[model samples]
Target: MPYLLLIFVVLFYAGNILTGKAMNDLPPFTIAFFRLLVAFIFLLPIGIKSAWKARNTFREYKGPFLIMTLTGVTFFNTFIYGALQFTTASNVSVLETVIPVVTVVLSALIVKEKLPLIKWTGVALSFLGAVWVVMDGRLLELFSSSWNVGDVIMIGAISCWAIYSIVVKQYMHLFPAYGVLLVMTGMSVLILLPFVAVEWTIGSVPSLGEVKYWIGFLYLGVFPSVIALVFYNRAVERLGASQASVFLNFLPVVTMIGAYVWLGETIKLPEIAGAFIVIAGVILTTRAGTRKKRKSLNYKKTSYN
Candidate 1:
């Protein structure tokens, strides 16, 4: 599981690098559209087979399935990609680390999940770490022109993702994960088609001359979007959402590495420190949740057996 998660982190960083490269050639939405489009093409066969096998289940979940696809694939990806246009990869990645915090708060409010004190502390620490990283340790710079519109867009994107995560956790028990992903990918592709068409009409279509662009597209479609998601769902199924969220703490580190190698971007000391704090907080939060889950399981077993 650790090895799989490590690979997921690597791919996640690769996706960030790829987005950085592609954002130059195309608008964020167009780039996102194509990324999903490629994944849709690759998974269409499997999705079709799965849909056929689970036709009855799909019929029963038409409404929920639609909502899940819209939120997860369409809204989340579109917003993130668009936000990338205005933000630095480092800023975006660090901010994204707060997604679990958003998810936790939303879960508490919407699903009535109670957070332990330790976990709440961890969440607070993680959020502070994210802020530090976003500000690059120059606390005062946060309010300066050094911050751009992209940062604001990223916050909005994070909110969309947090909402999407909660919605999936709420509805996934009703349908298979792959089935839901397949449907969502398909629907997202359809939603973006007209946008892609408009972009093509307005200007010449983006070319694939640069090797980096193709590499980025392939990495985004196959790894982060497709393969990483498979691993994520499996991890969530086995470990539960609260536990699985800790792994996302690794995302910023991986992204930083990718940025350095692929984009030749330099990382400052504060960024490194912030990443560590975020990871520590994530660990604490997950450990707290695990203990809670065990106690609940023990209570249920005592009552039933």
Candidate 2:
């Protein structure tokens, strides 16, 4: 179930980049504001009902709410949209491949996550493969051409997602994903409102009347903002954030396909090779970790008996 959700999330997020690639007319914060506002509206009724039922639980975990608001709502998309204005979506997607590693490492540091050696090696290999594609067979060029301003900002954005996923994992069952989405979207709207206002003052507002902008706007609100998060949060619930994050390593594959279809970009051989390598690493790490976990669980049960 969660795997299916991640597939939908991958496709929706591909659209996020595709739309963001061409949303030069809108300020990043402003676009985030609109996206969250529309999402909040769409989820209001159902979300309100669910949240109402969970009011006491929501209050009990205000800390999680705040963390979710900050990480998921606060600036992830703002930073991503900001980066998209300055780099190709494909390039941005390449940069995003670092996120699963970020999530894993952060989970280790922040949550004391432990993994087998093979899984760790898989993580490292996946990163090398992503860098392989980004550097186009010249690994040395990675050091030389790695940190454009946009790519650096994107790092910050994906970091936000990493943190958000960690928090989501912590509260996977404690907080309902639906209510979390509502509250996070609502908080994000509040958070980005002033920033969007600043952009509006600076003549950086989007053309709300433009049909193309509307299409992007609606797609973002409906698909990535609302639907994707539901799927993503559920994946976090079922798989744990660190495991769910491995799925994100596949983003570039979806982005590459979407880019070709929507933006008429051509796929490259390096990207294909990198995509396969990343998938290989994801499979190795996840499968090995699961097997180890099952072994441990069986040992514990036998000892108890």
Off by over 4 Å in 1: 1-14, 21-23, 145-147, 209-211, 238-243, 297-305
**Which candidate leads the pack in TM-score?**
2
* lDDT tens per residue, model 1, 1-305: 64366456546654654465456557766777777877787777767776667778778877767766776567666666766777766667766777777777787888786677898788777767767765778767666755578777777767876776666666666665566567678778888888888878887787758777666777677666777766765666555554455556556666766777877889889889988887787778767777877999999999999
Error of 2 at 291 (Å): 1.4
The lowest-lDDT stretch of 10 consecutive residues in candidate 2 is 128-137
Q: How far off is residue 157 in model 2, in Å?
A: 0.7
What are the per-residue Cα lDDT tens digits for candidate 2 across 1-305? 77789878888887888788788667788788888888888889878878778889878988887887887777888889999878878678777778888998999999998766887878777777766765666778777774667887898888899999998888757766677788888888888888778888887445688788777888998899989988898888877777777777677778878878877878888877988887888788778767887998999999999
Runs in model 2 lying further than 4 Å from the true structure:
296-305
lDDT value, candidate 1, whole model: 0.70
Q: How close is candidate 2 to the true structure, as a TM-score?
A: 0.92
